[model samples]
Target: MSTLGVNTGWRARAACRDHDPELFFPTAHSGPARAAQAAAAKRVCAGCPVREACLRFALAHLPHGVAGGLDEDERRAVRRRGAVGRPVARPGPRVLARRARAGGCSAAQVAMWLGVSTRTVHRWTAGGAA
Candidate 1:
C-alpha cells in the first residue's frame, strides 16, 4: 500500500519499512512505556543504510512520533540547535495541515513547531484568511 513519491529512493532502503509504523508513533505518552517504544524504533534506525537521509527527511517533514531514531522533541531540539540544513517549506500549509491531522497531532501543533499562529493554521486548513 505504499505510494510512490519523493524520497522513494532512500525510503526504499529504510530498515523500518519492514516494521509496523505504529512502532514509530509510540502509543505511550511518557515514562517507561514511551522509552521502550522509542528504544524499539531506534533499534531499527541503528542499522539503517538510509539513516542519515531519513534523519534529514524527518527534520523537515515529520512533526510527531519517532523518526530517524529520534522523537519529535529530539528533532525539535536539533532544529533549534541548527544542526542540519533541512528545508521545512516543501509542503504548503494545506498539505501540512492534512499531515498533521493524520499524524494525530493538531495542525495548530504543527504551526507552533513552524512558529505560526494556530488561527493562521486554521485559515490555511480552510483555504482562507482568518
Candidate 2:
C-alpha cells in the first residue's frame, strides 16, 4: 500500500476491509442484540465515505454480507427506495470519437503521455473507455 496520498491506492480504499469490522457483529445474536448492532452500524456509517458502495454490495448480496457498517437486513431497507430521477446517460459514439481524436496525437499518444498501458490506449482509440 502506497502511503503517498490519502486516497490513491487500492490499499487505502481497502483499509476497512482489512480491519473487517463486520466480524464484530455476528448474525447469530438475538433480536435485541441485533437491534444494538444495527444502531452501532449507523454510527460507524456516519463517517464512511464509501458508505454507498458498502450499502449496495450488502443489499445485492443479501442474507449475508455487510456494508456501511450495516449487515444484510439493514442494507435491504436502504435499497427499497425510489429513484430521484437524476437523469443518468452514457456517452455517445461521437463523444467517444472526439475523445479518441484529441489534438493531433490520437488516443495512443494521450495514453502514453498519461503513462498507462498500450492496450488501454487501444481501447480508447476503439471508443471503449477505461
lDDT score, candidate 2, position 33: 43
Candidate 1 global CA lDDT score: 0.70
Per-candidate local distance difference test: 0.70, 0.47
lDDT of 2 by residue, 58-78 (tens): 455545544555566544555
Q: TM-score for model 2? A: 0.39
Query: Which number leads on lDDT?
Result: 1
The 10-residue segment of model 2 with minimum total lDDT is 82-91
The C-alpha local distance difference test score for the whole of candidate 2 amounts to 0.47
What's model 1's lDDT at 92?
A: 49
Q: Write the per-residue lDDT of candidate 1 for residues 3-72, one digit (tens) a residue.
A: 2344547787799989999889988887545655665687687689987778887887889988876789
